[model samples]
Each structure stands twice: as C-alpha cells, then as structure tokens.
Target: MIISVRVQQILLLLTLLVIGISREIIQLELWALPLALLSGLVLQGIGDSKRRRKWNIASVTISCLSLCLLLRTQNPYVLFYAIFFTVLSKFLIVYKGQHFFNPTNFGIVVCLTVFPNLSWVSPGQWGNYFFPSLALSVIGVLVARNAQRLLTAFSFLSFYSLMLLTRYLYLGDPLSIFTHQLKSFSLVIFCFFMITDPRTTPRSFKGQILYTFLIALTGYLLQFHFYIREGLFYALFFICLLNPLINKLFPAKEYQWAKKI
Candidate 1:
C-alpha cells in the first residue's frame, strides 16, 4: 500500500526473517498492522505525495514490521502508542533547537511506565534469558538492521558487554554476569532497531560511529553498574539532539553505491 518496489523487497526479506525465527507464522502477523501503520504515517508525512519514495517507504515499513516481529509480542496498540508519543515528542519538545528525546525512545519509556507487566521483550536481558534472543539475532541484527548504522550498533553492543564483563570480573563472579549478558536478546534488538534509527543518528559515517559509541557506552554504564533500566531509551534520546549537525560537521560522500531499482 505504501509504495511498490522497495516495500515489496523489504517485505520479502523481513518475512524471510520472521519465518526463520518462528514455527507459527500467525503469531508474528499480529504485530504487523500497527507497526506498518505507524511507519507509514511517519514516512508519508515526510514523503512526497506525487511520485513514490521507493526505498524510503520500503525501508521504514520493513524496519517497523521487523521490529514488531522481533519484539515477539502481541500488543500492537502499545507499539502504536509508542510511535505516537515519539512523533509528538520530536515536534513538540525542542530544546535549543533540538528535540530532547528520540520519539521511539520516549515511546518505550512511556511504555515502561504504562505497561510494566506487559509481555514486552527486550533483547538486552541475557543469561537464563538467552534462548529467547536467538530470534532477535537473526532478524534484528542480521536482517532488519540498517547496514550503515550497524557498526555503531555493534560498537555499543560490544562495548556495553565489555563493561558488563568487567563488572562481573570485578565483583568476582565473571561467569554469572556473562551468563546474564547472554539473555539480553532485547538489548540486541533495541540496538539494531531503536538505537540505529536514521532520523536520530548522525548522518556521516565517522560521526555515526562516534555517535554509536557514545550511546553504547552510556547504555553500558547505566545498565551494568548504575542499574538504570532506561539506558537504551536515554542513550538514543540524547544522541538524537546532535543529529542535525551531522551534515554540517561531516561531508556526505555520494559514492555510486546505491543501485537504482
């Protein structure tokens, strides 16, 4: 419904990821509608009305759909509410010419307060929680993730894990902490899905790398030692404040890389 080529391309790829992760296809479908709607709204609002935005619509649609599937939950309304709040936050609260929080991060925070007991899955909760994360590994990291932003995502993941690993060793129980890190499937998913949001991150490659590292480092510091539950959301929220300056700070190289479909 959004566009044609890009939407189809991303849909096929995302569907492949979902099928790879689940035995029951219908369970994943429950999350599709609301997510698609939310992404559609975002893309459509910013997109042109006359001609189609081939890859952009497809990218956003796949991203939202993949997030829903990777989330492995049934509350479409929660995701929708999160999307609504995120968009509202972006336009509503500008501080020194920048919005205070990434819309998605704010939405997730809102969800935590509103639906703590809800079956929301976070990929960061590892250890005994490890098994549930494999799906995310395949979809969130491998497929749904934007390749450009992944380096930053992985940098944060690796650095954050290292901090946790350090804490475990410091506390004299390295194995225990390592095990707990394994169950953090949602954290992994969150990194690829939420942290790497194009609208939030810096535009240049180097800046994006730096941006990713900071977000990851912050998330790690809060999660491992300070025990801040809202690290991911906080990390992304603050990082987004710097997104605008990316183009001004770093020159965007237009290599003949993106093949026109």
Candidate 2:
C-alpha cells in the first residue's frame, strides 16, 4: 500500500506518541497515542498518497534510530511504532513546514502533561550516546539536512549554562554548575533532538542562535523556580511561542524566516 507524504507523517506521529505513552515515560496512560491519533483523525482527516522515499528514509533514520540508539532510554517500546510524531505535529501546526518550535519537544510536553510520571531520560552520563551527535551533524550535512542546527544547539546550551551559573552563584551552591550542565540529560537531549528540529527552529544562522539561547535562558528559570527536570522541553515550547513574534535588534539575512514557495 502506498502512502501519501502527509499521511505518512500523521501515522508516524501517532506511532511515536504510542511509543512514548507505552514506555511510561510521559503522563499518558495506555490510550495516550490513541488519543493523539484520534485527535489527528478528527482534526486532520487521514489522507492517502504515496509516501516519498527520501522523506520517509530521513524520518526513519533520524527519528526512529535516535529513539532507539542515540537516546539513553531504558524503554524498549520507544522504537516500536515506525513513525515520528514530533515532525508530524509540525506539519499540522505551521504552514509550509517552516516552524520555530521543535515538534519533538512539543510532544514531550504533551507526554509530560498527559503522563507526568512518564520520564524523558537523560544521556549525558552515557559515553556512547554522546559522540553520535557529532555523527548526526555530519549526516545532517551530508543529506543537506537542517543547516542552522549547530547554531541553534550552541545558543540554547550556552545560554542555559549561563542561567544555571547565575542561579548557582545566587544560591551559594559550592558545586560546579558547569560540570552539572555538562552532565545534564536535558542539555544533551535538547542539543541533539529538540534544538535541531528543522521545522520549528529558524533556518538562518543568527536566527537559530537567538532561538536556541532563548530556550536555554527560559529553561534555566523554570528549573530554578520549579525544578522541572524536563524544563528544557517547556523552555523550547516557550521559545517556539517567542519565535513567531521574535524580532532581532540586530538584523541579519541568515536570521530571516525560511522562504516558502
């Protein structure tokens, strides 16, 4: 059976949602994915068209493999559904697939609210998971993948570090926030997964940098105030909220929104 591009996306999304819910990593109970899937069905009627090979391959390669290999997850079911819900939400939310919010992060939020007990694991402790991100960057380049990936990642991470450093100084905590920042699973995952979401993040170099820094700053505040482990997820969502209206004081062409034909 042939699948259309859009249809494939919807299926992939619901599949990942199921995986997340099933893993008990988020708040949703048994029917979490089904709920999201049902919503997609009602809101965006399922379409039938032949799936594009390259797009499917890319989605499967990154989203699927990342779920399985790169992330330091104990859940076996994370990779069960052969789909990517994060990107699927992107298609639904934005026009022409240009987004400033990471779909994966958004999904994490949904999972968090729906299933608070469900955890999004950290991988900074894992050595193997660390360096593969470098590989993904190269692969992203080889496939002509998201261009502003590093810019977005560095901006978010660096600023997030600064926020922590500030808070640690204010709190008089003797522990090194720098090492803590490096060891955080949230930081690792955001740099690799959420910050790199092509649709939600800006395409231009300067824009991505600004967008990333915004996430880091907000995440720091949330963690300091509320102590949310998945503060990065909420931070990314806030940044996405900001990106639509964000205007740079200093103008650069790379920071401009993607041109949609």
Q: What is the per-residue lDDT of model 1 for residues 1-261, given as tens digits with 9 covering 90 to 100?
A: 434434543665465455545634325554556565665566445543322434344444544555454343456666666555655565566654445455556666666667777635444323245555666565555443355656667766777777777777778885966777656655665766666555455657787777777777777767656877666666666666666665458756432214221
Q: Which parts of model 2 have CA positions greater than 4 angstroms off? A: 1-55, 67-87, 96-100, 117-147, 175-177, 247-261
What digit string (tens of lDDT, one per residue) describes model 2 on residues 115-165?
Answer: 444335453333333344455434333322334655566566667767777
Each prediction's TM-score against the native? 0.61, 0.58
**C-alpha lDDT of residue 161 in model 1:** 73
lDDT of candidate model 2 versus the reference: 0.50
Per-model lDDT: 0.57, 0.50
Pairing residues by index, what is the TM-score of model 2? Answer: 0.58
